[model samples]
Target: MSQTLKQPRNSTERAGFRVDLQGLRALAVLLVMCYHIWFSKVSGGVDIFLMLSAFFLTSSTARRIARGQRPPLVDGWLHRFSRLIPQAAVVIIGVVIAAWIILPSTRWLELIDQSSASLFYWQNWYLSDHQVDYYAFNTASASPLQHFWSLSVQGQIFILWPLVLAGSALIWKKFFSRHNFAWVAGSAFGAIFIGSLAFSIYITATNQQVAYFHTGARLWEFALGSLLALALPWLSSLPEKIRRFGGWAGLLTVIGSGAVLDVQGQFPGFMALVPTVAAALVIAAPAPRSWTNPSGLLSLSPLVKLGDLSYGMYLWHWPLLVFYLEVSGKQKASFLAGTVLILVSIAASWCATKFIEKPAIAWQASASFSRLIPQSGFKLIAQFAAVAVGLGVASLPVMAWENNVEHRRAMAAAQTATDNPGANATEGWDPSPTSLVLPLATELDSEWQTPGEVCEGAAAPDDERIRFCEQGGTFDGGAPDLVLLGDSHMQHWSAAASAMIEEAGGSWILVYEPGCRYGSDADRVKETCSDFQDAAQDYVADLAPEMVLTTASKTVARPDAMLRSPGEQEILVDNYEAMIQPLLDAGSRVIAMRDTPRYSYSIPECVDSNKDNFANCDGSVGYALNSVNPVEKFLDSRDYGDQVVSLDMTGLLCPEGVCKAVIGNVLTYLDDSHLSKTFVLSAKNQFASSFKEATNWE
Candidate 1:
């Protein structure tokens, strides 16, 4: 048996040459497991696994159909469910129970919600929309079931792949033979592979976050593998030397891919081709001599045994890693510790596979013996119903938590009193904005909105020079002489700035974008924020006001770096030097305002969710503490910082290092980070003196 498993010498010389493709299966699964565990750079394992899945599932289904047998869709689905669900269920239940014990109350609820979503297929979309950082940042929480994203993608394929094969087989029987069907199927899949690859590459370049989650972009890799399987009979006819060469080359390609790739490498795009193609090549080749087979690499008693438990291992590993991280609060495990962890995980996976999975599958298979037996058509329908109920139940808390109107009303009243102190401190702050406030309420509304707009400020000007200097259509003649140039951060300070400028007899002009930062590069952006930075720059340089002011969120830097990278830092410095040099040379001052500290809690939801407990609402403080400060590092550069005046707001928001989101029913922030309009309006008076000193407003 061992000798029979060895690589074939020649095609004609060897009859029924066996390649141990399951050995390749062992290879594919292990590669993925290792990549997830440590390497972080290579997605070669995932690409290879995708190809293997296409090869096995598509080829097996097509063969069954071509042999004039109708596949039992329900039974086949049951088999797949039996194979996958047992392990998945064990992981989900274990993770959920563990999370309930270990996580904070708020986070525990989020885990329950997310885990339930994972049981259904929508977890991919859920994580994608949330922009869940899979690399697991130090401050952020990890999703134990995140690895299920790939499994969900595969299950999606399983759902539809057989139907395509069955449909193609029907057409072939009506018009031609089984051989013709393979060719037709191969051609169709080839087209899908090509189109999907192009789309994947395009989306990765355009919207990588979206591309990462998109199944459409990933589907082609699998199709490519399936196409190879359809052509296997023709490939098997090749000379033994060619077949043997292909098999060896395939293994080399896959292993080499794993060794070379890493986290920083681009993925699921054109880069994935190396391992995917190699997997196809390996699948096409016949088995080596059974006993002396190079297939022994996968067939090793230990490896094969691990391979049997691999499905469960994959399900359990991530959650375990997450639980460890949560409990220990450290990402890097010592080498020995990591090794021990892996061994423990492997043992647990075996138990899960042997006990939970094997028994559950066996019971499920025996129609009458299944636990949680559907008692209805196909377990999927029952699963779907259960999943729907779970999700609906999960959503209720979030909705109820967010919809607290009484909290908002009370918050509004307190803010009104703070803003209009001189207008008779009557009956605890009038609820209406129309009462007892002049420029305080209306002017504040225009600048610091209740729920900020998507994009804001002046029309694009024709001359780049005149535009970049000016803020919001050539000096609106409002209050402040100093112009605020940039995005929403500048907008947040607009009301306070206006009050200060008015008191100091100066005018304020703002050139800004709603969801943008100051000085963002145009080429870097794909959506609405693309042209925003350049447009604002033109306004600042053109207006040439006495001083330019702006602020930004620190976390915005990461996504910005990704969008327009390479020489970005240098380019930004140059642009600032060039744009502001002309202003400074022309006698205009440049002032870089320190961005306000983001609230630890989402203020709007806080009043409702935690009902006044600021400490409880705030999440892990470590990440929030590390968030960016525009003023902190603005002076690092030689060119622009020389002319920049720094204004620190840390004292205002976080006095004594503790920031409160709600101060006596006055919510400080409308959302997670940005300051609320009502809060900003009330606080403008406090900032007036500082504004006068910074801008030299006379």
Candidate 2:
């Protein structure tokens, strides 16, 4: 997960080769690579690497403190980063270029953001902020740079761990004798271990997706490693046979962990102890002299050499795998293909180690020819800064190109409504052909619609479950007050609704959650969805808006299958009726818009690739939607009277039974399910007419 460091010697021994540690590093990196490539599981190897990084850092710093010498904090940081940044910069640059060349344009903007985050060692924080689920099965669209999150975490700890050690050393020198430094350091790390572990457990239980990338949740692994380093001498004094048994047991436990444990879902928490403790056992036990022993096998020259290249290998493998999948259009790599990838990765890593990493490691920043270039820590840090700056400067052109593409997309989106009729093209209006698609593939990431401002005053929902509440359009006296409520499906209709409301001199409020449905009572729906439904119902009742809008059905589709089952349609209609009963009671007419068709592929990417013949990307409306609106069937079956109305816009969305990706030269769906804001804006006229008819609002 990070660059391996030379372990410090015990008090009785001189600093020398640590073959066992080298082999351990090799094994850990191998596990990480295997799990990522072949198994698609968390091997817990990165956890082991984190522990080892802290172990080496603590042992070296503690020894320096005990020897009556100040910890070389500036020199230590510069040296560590100088070694890490150059090699990482090489991989980052490679991934950037490869992504531009091989990956879909839909992924380019995200790559730019993730690449920048990775270069600056803040990738974990970026991922945590996005709430990315590391274990999600979307490998085809997965970021090649995701593996950098572990390295970023280690890079952060490399800076913080030393400062903590120095502070502890300062405390010990000020208050206690040098002999008590171990106890002082142990107490500090033990507290961190306990606190971080408790926090990790709680966060993992509550929000495992975010907890997986959160750096604070992982600090305990490093603390545990530091604790083990402080206890190494005591551990080495155990009986030789016992040490050997511990070593073998630790190795087996580590090897079997991914297979036996629910590692993807239950890791970096209490379950993480399984691998970190196993690593500690291996580190604590001395290398066995016998070839048959776990330590002896680990001490092999081939494994040691692999360990030397581990950091580079770790950096190279993931991006290579990602690019391979992208180019080949495979969900997972075949064994033969994976083998070729690994071999190429090993070769690339060797080149990086030989040409970039090893040279940087050997470069003496302090070696100066004259007085102008003084031998100082500043020079060393400057050298590291130069590498980062060079990488940043190199990325400038790519960023500029992305900006240019986005600018073009904006200009295209702002063209006359007639130029990009979108759904209105379904009305048999002939549209002129244009070379460019409105809201280009590069612009898809920003296509989701949002209200003008956060909902405030009495309009805002008091319930915490209604985390997202926003309003747009004029709220002037005598204007129609409308509320749009539900999940993202309802939210996507905001562009057309806002345009219609603004033109009519009215205001609209949007209460939305990404995945939560309005009336979902399915056992699989998160508890938050139920709470949000309750909050939305109360908010609608309190506001008593003239009309409330929500999605009345759900789309069910797969790449190979597109139709929803009859039972599924019935369930959705039932959920909708229960949801709107409250709104009807509150004198708010429910304008239930039929849900948009969901596709099994990226609409933008499909349109981008098939620009010359985008009709190839079109789907059958009958397959993407029900033969009849399920909500209307439910309405007719019962007598909800005039309060409940079904507003089916499938005619505008999928004209002549076809759901097109690009209609009237404008991109429709943002991805597979959501509508692009530009396309929705094009539908404003039709949407307004439909709204007036449904609500009987002047």
Candidate 3:
């Protein structure tokens, strides 16, 4: 239910005749829908759509060049975008309203950003930078507007394809004035197809996830369609028998390819040739060469009618599917529900095409809508103004609505904790610190002191010039005596650590790096991590504290990528011992606490949506721990004697083997892996009691 690709671009319109391409459009859309709804497989429908768009685009440009009326680049670009964006605008506005009503507030920021990216034609690039998981759908949430990535790609190409045609027109005027521009254009596109196909095959093999959404990686599909537009005239000369066989073969191949091909890493490569060529064969089949054209079956009324609405259908289906999944709380829709969704999408598509798209296109093409005045020279300016004004007007309300909602929530949260005098002494076990009331999600942190103290992403020089900076201390009539260390996992616990240091009448030193787990005998560390670890060793040796506290395990790695076998676990334990044993040797007691449990989805959003009984977000400790915490499992399974203190804090977070996102009316974790500072500060007394028992201090 995540995505479907369709091609109802009206491809045959450029020839000034209905070549029955609408039938192909109907077929392509149905293939995409069935694959997305039920099969959980890609049908090569997106590749075919890419080809069809190029096919029509090249045909129209060639016809103009053939008649010596070269396509005006800016005007063509305006019309192309105008044809597409209105329907897309309607869908985006609808999704914005639905998101505000149904989706959790935590998702609002990302959804708003995606809506902006969709309005502009950069969603594909945005998704690429984010490293979106296009292949899988998690149980908790799916981006309702994720399908806009394809539309963004198409829009970018629509703008650029005209420039390509313009280039061909330049070549025709300069070098080959005698020959028709078709040959010159065909030869140029032919070379492009060869080069881009090679690039596509290489990148797809190397990184399919990135290449899947990358415009450069899929340009070859468009190039092939451009070349086919020129070649179709020559191909039309084939006899009736051969053309009939090819038409049938192409139709059958389009229907059957999805059933056989597994398009994981193998797409947009040579495998994508199946659908692109099938669609080309259907386009090139000569219907007028014979009386009984079996391909005439495409001229049927119902299929043509569906094709008329295919673009709108593609836009409408995915958000509906995603919203249904959100409201119904089902990962995949039941058969009955999916059928109902399909029917509703069809109805919506009909309305969008009939009432919105057709009328908008007609109006935009009118003399008044397209010209600043009755004058001729200002048409481009007029087109720009109209498209810009139309989109600006459509999107501003959505922007204002989300902003108002966020402002109200923030204002309400700001009203808590007016006094700021003292902690509540008589609350339940592990209560949130009542001294300073927190926002619902506790999004801000006062004790955060990691990246600003150190140049987080900077690499160390070959020679040492202060490799890392150290920060965090309190000198309230007492000497500094505590030093905390490790990756972000250790960093997030600063709230509890700060409270403990204050109670013990001392200050603190915090040495941390992002994602740089303190490892010694494992895979190679980044240069910065290795340098930080060395500097940390020297600092601890120079100013040895009473105790060195650090996290010994992490749950940030995905389950598939983690090492879980006993042999792998032993290596992790070896790395942990090697990393922390130096502090213990430096005349400082070291406590390596068992890392906290992780969640598969964001905890705050789940709690926000299910607020009536937030316990519905309880995840089993097994899933909470998952595969990445085996180092803790290995450390806890055996004895390392008294040199290293191995403290287990899992039970305080996960009582009775269930790790709920909420406890004591405050969210336990802000996100998937990190505990919120507010929640940790809430547990200050518990942390004091545990530290005292483990170290026999105070």
Candidate 4:
């Protein structure tokens, strides 16, 4: 992409003609395109591309300095970003509008956040912070901006690289060889390569997900390219056959990387060296001899043209793939369908490059604008202002519309509350299935403020401590507690429990671990969750809490076992028994509420598409009711002491032979299994009465 850079005339003449590199760009982008569209694989193409970008940037900057043309740092920054932002902003804006129109409103806030993060090139961090399961294409909708992670990494390097180059130049001129600028730069890059490589290896091994998007872990690839650029003069001096051999070998490596390696899971570590070094060999190889130089294929006119459009292709392909998936509702596409999407992506890329990218670059390059403006950064200011305005325009209205829908739904739910033939909710929870109060499309972000506001992982001295919460918004540390234990199923029921505990009069402690089923003494694998359960056992034993409320369940479908075994059921009961054994011995009764229904798809998405008939999204009563179908049977087989009382919510949730997505205007489940805090709150009256009857709570 030297063509993208504006080099000094002398430097352009001397460092001119690496059409091979342009061809490499085309190859890289195409690999990413095909893999994303059809194969659902990572190609290592982005890694190679990152290295090539750094190589060219470093080489161009060094050449400018050698020619005594002062490195126009601010101007370079502006030029690169301006060249980038127009195309990127266009894609982001297009995606924003597309998401609003095509996707259910449940997806709006995330898309908005992604768009804003992409605009500032902090997408990688944003996604990581949100703990998005980047690998889970089957379970979750892939964000269109997910591919921006690489762009964001490159953007960070683009800003920081020039400063490092300038500093290295100063040290070389003042102390090191003045004429041997390449040696100084290469040595600097060599050191960076070593340090960054070590860090990359460590981070990738321990935390591959975070390492995958981390700019720090990726710095080695860029440094490897810079090292190659500075060593090109020596490599070019090699025997013609050797250099030609290197080129062919490198080309094969670049093309075959995806086939040979698991690039997605083990990237930017030592594994990344395969493609980066191959790209280096290609860049360093001298002008190819007629003896079958792969450069000839790479430098083909059409390939080079595609290379020019590579950036746009990279930007456009992902959103198109995501849009297609959203429409198709399939995890992977068929070859024919994927091909059409790819072809359209290519066409879109070409138009964007020709009409938007090329014109924008030309204008920015030809402008009379001062590079000094970037010192004060009007560009950043303008970009943030644009994002703020865009988000306000995009999100505020959606919020209002969702709010209005929720308000009307709430009114309907109120009527349902009055009209329903309430059952013996305590003996067996059966509010008799009223209408859903909240819209199926409602995100219930406000309602998600449970299991309570301050809930999180254990927080002190690298030691996990039990979590305590009080009814009526107070947490007294030394109170005889009403403990809620187990996973998110147990966590979600806190709304009802807290209200009942407050009415019954005592402080309540919520000992919740999201994924763990309250297994004890190493039965749980996650250290924090395991520790939370152990700590809960210890606390309940000593405190002798009046009641320990928990659910015996798992949210993910155990299809193999749901009908046959509940293979997880034995594990669930064992963990629960162990957890409450100590509490039972200490005279504390265990209140085992059964888990709710689990669905395969997003309930909100289903509801949005089928609003007037939400039962369309409902699952069969036999398949859906965990508490009644499997949990009750399992509980009957166990003798967890007489004080241990089992509560089934299935009667309330599955009143008409189907477990519906919405009940009493309360969206029953937040995702697919766990009840929404609002739904729990709505059913609290019945829950309290049940508690008073079952345990004789005062």
What's the count of clashing pairs in each model shown? 44, 0, 0, 7
Q: Tell me the alpha-carbon RMSD of every candidate.
A: 9.9, 4.1, 6.5, 5.8
lDDT of 3 at 34: 71
TM-score of 3: 0.78
TM-scores, all candidates, are 0.67, 0.88, 0.78, 0.84
Once superposed on the true structure, which residue ranges of model 3 sit more than 4 Å away at CA? 1-16, 132-140, 238-246, 288-294, 365-386, 405-413, 416-452, 455-488, 498-588, 598-601, 615-642, 650-660, 663-665, 681-689, 696-698
Range of the 10 consecutive residues with the lowest summed lDDT in candidate 4: 1-10
- Candidate 2 stretches with Cα past 4 Å from truth are 5-15, 132-140, 178-180, 365-368, 371-435, 452-467, 470-481, 506-508, 538-545, 559-572, 585-588, 635-643, 693-697
Worst 10 residues of 1 by lDDT: 1-10
lDDT (Cα, tens digit) per residue for candidate 1, span 263-355: 224677887787877766666655554433345454465555555555666667677777776678576455665666677777887786677
- In angstroms, what RMSD does candidate 2 have relative to the true structure? 4.1
lDDT of 3 by residue, 378-456 (tens): 5555556657865896688677876775775566455443322112223444423432223343232332434223322
lDDT of model 3, residue 571? 25
> Pairing residues by index, what is the TM-score of model 4?
0.84
Query: Tens digit of lDDT per residue, candidate 2, span 426-481?
Result: 56676556546777777665678885699876676778878988888777643237
Which one is best on lDDT? Answer: 2
Model 2 CA lDDT for position 685: 88
